[model samples]
Target: MSFFVRLSLVLALLLAGGCASLSQQQRDQAQGIAVAARSTEVNCDRADRCALDSPLRALGGQAMAESTAQAPRHYATILDEGELSLVARLNLIRSATRSVDLQTYIFDTDDSARMVIDELLAAAARGVKVRVLIDQLSAISDVHMLSALSGAHANFELRVYNPTFGKAKLNYLDYAGSVLCCFRRFNQRMHNKLLVIDDVLGVVGGRNYQDDYYDWDREYNFRDRDVIVAGPEVREMAANFQAFWVARRSVPAERLNDVGKALLRGGVPALPEASFLHPERIEWVDEEAADPDFINQAFVATALPVQSVSYVADLPRKHRRERAEEPLAGQHLTEPRLDALIASAQSEVLLQTPYLVLSKPAQKLFKNLRKRDQPPRVVVSTNSLAATDNPIVYALSYKYKRRNLRELGFNIYEYKPFPLDAPIDYRQLLPPALDGLPPVPERNRMIGGSAAGSNVRGSGSGRKPSVNGSEVERDVLRTETRPSFLGTRAVNRPLPVTRKGARMGLHAKSMVVDRRIAVIGTHNFDPRSENYNTEGAVIIDDPRFAEALAQSILRDVHPDNSWVVAPRQKPPVLSGLNYSIGKASEALPVLDFWPWRYATDYEFKPGPDCPQPLRRQDPGFHACYSAVGDFPEVDVGPKWLLVRMLTAFGAGLVPIL
Candidate 1:
């Protein structure tokens, strides 16, 4: 029988019998697992000295002061310019001397993930206490190997949040079983992505430890963003990590499987170089020559002069509170605090998220914002139908609810993927379809970034220069008309990277408050992030850093990068009908754009296609997906129809997915 047939059989047994019966040997294997219900309390951040001044203080030349005394002043350095973001993360790992605490939603079994994890293991071996807390949903592949890595060193510990029964690390079947068996808890995942080393530095944003997050994927790359926070506020970040580390919701990796105990047997080395898959991954970056100088510069560059900084977090058990257990009126709630932060915005607000399923309460908050006489200028940037990694979310939020959002003064911009610039190298890394991409203009990416009031195109390269006797015009066009009453502008920005990749997905979750205060974290301003997952962010209230961040975001709204979404004409009848149908059927909801989902041609893809380097794909092994494959999740047999049926009838699930 085929694998699908076997999967269906196994699922039938699982649903009917609750679980399959284990053989004597299987039972023996499981008996060795540390299945004890209680966990020992431990301080993961005992060595945290983030509150003190570091020997290496960043921005010594820059002049700035904080607006608040209670908050520590720091700077935010955005890694959105180019491939510098990739090294910035790795550099943080290498710079750690005392401890490294990493928590994320997903850490896939990809080249990027391998390199980062290997670095962590190396750090642990160097007596740097390393603690890794990952959402169980993302630990599907390489679980056994990860468990071994965790047990290999006494200083390293791996804990998974809300795991399921059976071969969780190897199969996606356990997700369905988990959702079916424990619907409520299973949906409430830990969505926060955070990394802090030695209690002083924290990197938070939408990135998970995967190849796509780092723009290294062969087929697609995420045009994602992350921010670095250093200084005293990192202590609070560490405290929040400690709380989650000991929470009842988090389970030790060894408790989930027997392989954790056999780690000492040491069959395969967990180092990235030893892997058959990514043995050559470490060589991607020319380390020996460039690394020493780069690391030194990055150590100071990553740290910013802060006016003020604060950390915000949702309790690990945010979704578990019962109706009666809810805090009384006027009580400060952790999950609701993000809303409070938004409410504090005075003149302007720039919101960026990936998935956007608004809850009833959130809708009401927007309603309140609309009622203000001088409402803050609200601009929201999220994934468009073509750019979204999760099409189901697009069906629900964009397909069904977008018009309503437009009516509420939301200047919505669907994030456009960075075009595959064909002027760069990576001859062996990417597929043949991707060629002639632009190179990262390292000279243009100056240390302090673009100055305020300079022309948007000022890279010191002067005027729009031509390459190879042709203008490097991008393919994106502005679809929005000027001066609508709704104050709603739709803009799509081009990906700034010059990497050899087919497409880009917007995975950055961030906000800019009044153009001075910035926040970066993993919370998607949607129902899933608001009510179903634990999320966090670090707030940097500094003018210089915020200006740098704003400069990057403003470029995304530039006409050269994205296709603006505005009503040149009334939306089509079919579009409206499909949206209504989608609302009625959230799961597998189809949009009018459904038929065009597979439109992967460079000429027609969502973002601007750079004109001169007109590198058309081979049209086979599509570089983009139109709601079919499950990457970083599952690959086969799990039908979308099942979700469709559930969405049509199961109203309770609307708040979950």
Candidate 2:
């Protein structure tokens, strides 16, 4: 046998010979001690979760009370701003009266995550039953932290979804071993971002529990989105959470190898008090959330009464081909919801995602849509090479530029790293009381961080010019690289050189169809979301909500914020020959070395000659837009080579990426 085959056999046996299951006596002893420790921490006298006074919660209650069976009215609000999104979640957690259920893909050890956890613990102290379900790969990796949380409160519980190697955390070697042994099962993840409070209100969308998702990351932040829903529809959201919670893959903290060992050893103290690097900044946000006027203006005013809303989600065991007959294991719900929405498109489909690589089913749907006589205009708002966090996925997108444009009939707009008009609050990046002052020099600021006791370091004191004539922070230009972990290495790999500072990648996953339906959720519209990950979404069928969602997506596609993808201006001589060669190169599975692609990035000129953005097919498009090369604003570096290499050789990664 070859060396590779022998190695695979050894790894497979190691995987099959899993860790011995803990004895019932051991589990009972740990549970008894943890419950005894938790009993002393009870702080509330009321049984009703000691619910706080919240006008937002009260408004939701009134809507639920007034809602009818036939009409089924729901109060739906779009959370486009990161600050507002965080505030909404905080307020809801504070006001929970019965239970708080949170399911997420990432629960990072950042300050923002600490704030949310602090609130959840407080809710538990007040008699609320709190359950947190997180993916093992991206959840809190600190074993001591997990042990502390294991005994924090009797009312609070945490579970890791799909723990590989039966451990709470996977090291580098374990990750590699899993790939060699059980790639399919290990590759599956729980990508749902959901929070249900009192089974009455729920928030679902793409925002994860991380600083970047909430615009608190000074180095980088995500231009993401979420939605809040209340009334009859929230029941469905709660049901979906319960389904995943009871699923076999949801392993309790005390059941995992690392966390269980710590629990068995005892002396695991309760979770530490929340410590924030910028407590004053968090205080300001808390004060804003508490302010009745701010809550009414930011959330209540924006909420609309929608007649139709539904929650759709994929089951926990989403990729069980052998058990395909089982409804809970084999069925894919989120994909069908998306497919049905796109299939019903009459005039247009506006999609916004960080990655543009489409699954085969998605490709077929769009391709069929293009076969219509006057097909609906398909516009995609996605990340460019300069802005994207996952260049590997972007490479696959780059490889299929011709198909996405000429065949799928998509009008693609790539988001800029530092958009001029994104709805981000940069004030949060500053330390307390320094909001209005000039940018602080690196040597002067020394903030401490929570994760790994790492200090919040600053970039060098240098500035660089950006593509949009703005000064970028010196740090944005620097590349940060690490070993590939699962598929995330591809995501967190070093970004190509770009203008300095405050980079924003598109993380919002949404779709607006025909200005009558809108979807906001965790589905990336890619193969990972389609097959490997269990996803969730909220579909609203109200014209007003759809129009609002459409406008939000359009704002991201504005000339100041994104670059248009269009066919490059062909040479007057041998244009036909050039097209033929490019097409032939694109058709290859590997070694597609043609340099000149049919489509390239275009920057909109904002003079009287060209006052607004135009589609590529428009006759006056060339006059108004100038070609800015294929990967505009991206410096030629290792990342540039990586994209080309992956485009030529990464075809096998399409389904997994």
Candidate 3:
């Protein structure tokens, strides 16, 4: 081992030795507090949990009662907008009558997170069973917050999975020690995002409990997707939650190293009072959630009646050896099921994900599809260098451009950081009745103003440039909380102020095959998802649902919203020699120094001759489009340089990222 590895192991051992345990008296006192919290019920007269009246929740209960074994009917709704997604979650959570179980990868301390924590605590106080499971590295790192939760309520409980030093929080040194002592276990994470209520309804997708995921972040936001389902399949979701709840690595908060130590030293305390930075916005949402008309229009009217829907999830440990020991084990559920769906595609496959790094099996499957006599059209929507939060992963995608374009036949569209037609409601960022910001324009509409003589109506660089400014004070994650836990001091780095406002990155993981099948879940369709993280998805075989999903993804790829990636035009002199050199350099595992690339970004020219987007190989493509540099709107600086360096040397990090 190297000197650094040896030092890390020694420090890790010291950390293990420092872990504190509770004494018998302390343990008894903690249990007594839990019992008291559980017994002080506020809604003693109600048979059901004291759930708020909500039409959306009523539909979920109705669906479960009406479902049958022969034909399992489900009410499904596509959540394509960030504000609506948050509202849907809030409504469903408030409507839950029996229990609420949540599992996620990230639960930060922000406005959105505080809102959720408040709701869950209130639910627990009203005699509803509440449980939350978060991965250790990215869970709450505040010792005070963890302690408050540990003694908050008897019905409320929290668990951390695979803690490195048996602690709910990690310091910088602990993070380094974990990587050195146990790299494999450190890299494995529980990436599943799910919320089930009363064993009757569930919401699953890529949105996590963070301000950015809900478009409440001032500097950045995510254009994410999720689906709310109500039917017999929710029972399966409940069972999956139970499995993870009892998984070997899932450790309760009160039993953790730091939390246990704190509880022993300090007696049980009441849950801290919430002080939201934007109480007006929260109150507005709460009022709207209770409005019957708004609930009907936003959620109930959008629901689709589907007959065939099933949920697939990976086992908790997510390893082949671990699977062999369990009676419920079999082949991994998520990736193979997706592969089967893509292989069965007859015409086209519309896929949207933040990352595009393919696993070996995935690459092989696509290569085989390309070799077929008549291959399906694969259209992928992903992030550009300017839009992606992880530039290292983007570098790997940049490195494999030639192979992905020629061998796999992928027509890729990179999302713009400040797309013209982004589907975000800017009103949520301000107080209840603020009129300073520009109103949200109709999506996918073009305005006439740009140098190209056309612009997206609500484009980032438009009249609403200051929409990024929030009057409310922000509750940001502390800088010293936990650095490099997920391979970086901050999991998401702020984008270059190139556009001067809020930037959006694609976080929706979905696929539509042949306009007949739809999938929405946490799978990124990347190597890390396939190999390390546990993933899950809800598959619907209804044509109507597929068409809705297809339209949503199609809007993201509109010319006004994204840039098309196509091969650069070949030079007339020594074209063959240049091509040969490029190919040879791309084959190298490192030191790929060739400057010219096989593909570059292309912008569509709106005119009489080109009414629609043409295929990359179309003979008239050059007339309808013009080449923009490989990285547009990206400042020429460290991040830009890092992309080049990683593209040349970062191939090894693909599988783990």
Candidate 4:
């Protein structure tokens, strides 16, 4: 062989050898981490058995009945922004002693998630057992960060429910592939957000870990709700987490150690302490000495055995080939607590959701209520164009508000950031002094004196400036006492009232049922939420709680946080001829009455009417359009053209099933 040929062979051998070395290193690191995690696995089942004689067992036995009996009487506190609630949640976590189980759909590595993980790590450091279960697909985006969290402590265990190796990677390719993957395992996602601390307190609601969720940014914040239960329901939630944790495809963090190390090297921070490990020191009560009523109302729900209680969940089943033959079917999938509450409603339905894009079926349900003569009065509150974080979704929702009011026959209101009317405090406005005040000035004379002088000033000005000043002076004082007392009473005197400040954004997504049940969840009544992302919520069946929530929605959420979008007989006129001319110049063909085109592509340019960017920022430009330019319109073009294309596309996707 020639010298060149020999050199090429050597290079190939070295390259292959280096690859093998790297692979072995990864395998070794993974095995080491797995061994460490396995060594820390305590016999939790044994611990549960040991604690059977404890007060917890007695408390668990009566939790269900107590809950059912107190269902109608229970009062709920609404935690608006996740930031405020997170502090409470973390405090609970820090109080954990025996066990900590947490399951969520999304957990990012942002400040909020870090704060939680730091506490969890601290718990683990104190020898408190911890387990974290997250959806496999949802965690894919943050796997590196999660792996780092898992590696920091042996007491901490992480598992991903329903691990999809190759298929999940394929999902990243395109939308079509993702849709196909969804059909393959329609029952896969673990759509549960539960946190059980020491098996004593549990929390269930619609909140995920993301910056936007906690109101960290000024642009937008999710209007969501969650409840913290300190009773027997926590055990059920814990069991649910356990089942998912040990499922067939669940991948423990230790098993992913090698991958985690690689991920860390690629720059993911190590996990901190477990947030809720050691239980906080508190006064303890002997089981025999504890107050039954206290336990019944706060923990047990009623004097009923937990074994007799049934917990319902929307766990989908694996689709068989035979089942695929039927037309696609969606199940009723309603929580009993939620259904009961909705069924018991009597007076009105007041809903406050940041995202209120309802599905066709759900819309029809609301419409049917209107068709009946006894339709409950409805008030739907949501974000305005200026308040919404996602403009695209906002645009889509804005188009439907009018139709919902007119066709559905419901009273719809959008949240206005500004107050409608000023708050009047009659006591505060008691005229500085009720009596002995100097005579008030005359309106006509004062106006005339301030303006270019008139000839009337020649004779009228000299009249001793009469007490206050001319005929207008006496009229002013007379008008002060009553409107008609003024001279000639040419103009009407307005009432002495003050205006209040505008309300901020409404961030709670809830519905009141027959004034009986209240449904609060993370799921917005939006297409993307229903069809695309997995969601979860909790329904409480307490009339008092529901009423309080409803009142809050109306008084705080609706009045303070939302803009009331009312219909106008005429389109608002442009601020200037320049604005009208600009709009006319930019108008697309067949724009008016174009539903799809208008809904998707309609851009509210920052004209004088709209909130425009400051001139310092835009320079020569008057205002910027939507943060994302008119891409939807550019993609679909003219309104008429988009309608035809969308219609054809819908027809095409139909046969693919």
How much is 399 displaced in model 1, in angstroms? Answer: 2.9
Give me the runs in candidate 4 sitting further than 4 Å from their true place. Answer: 1-32, 37-76, 136-144, 162-191, 218-220, 254-312, 316-322, 325-332, 335-344, 415-507, 526-534, 570-657
Please rank every candidate by TM-score, starting with the best.
3, 2, 1, 4
What TM-score does model 3 achieve against the real structure? 0.90
lDDT of 2 by residue, 225-316 (tens): 89888888888988899989998999878777777777888656667667686676698778866777767766777788887899999986
Clashing pairs in 2: 473-500
Q: What is the TM-score of each candidate against the true structure?
A: 0.70, 0.90, 0.90, 0.57
**After TM-score superposition, what is the CA distance of residue 569 in candidate 1 from its true location, in Å?**
2.4
The 0-to-1 C-alpha lDDT of every candidate, in the order given, reads 0.54, 0.78, 0.77, 0.44
Candidate whose lDDT is highest = 2
Q: Specify the poorest-scoring 10-residue window by lDDT in model 1.
A: 476-485
Could you tell me how far off, in angstroms, the CA of residue 476 lies in candidate 4 after the best superposition?
A: 60
Models, CA RMSD each: 11.4, 6.4, 4.8, 20.4
**Where is the poorest 10-residue window by lDDT in model 4?**
447-456
Candidate 3 backbone collisions, by pair: none
Taking the tens digit of each residue's C-alpha lDDT, what string does model 3 give over 518-606?
99999999988888788999999988888888877877887877899999888988888887888898888899879998999999997
**Candidate 1 residue-wise lDDT, 211-301, digit = tens:** 6566455445566677676666777888989988998878666555434434323332343344524444456442621355554454454
Residue 370 shift from truth in candidate 1, angstroms: 1.6
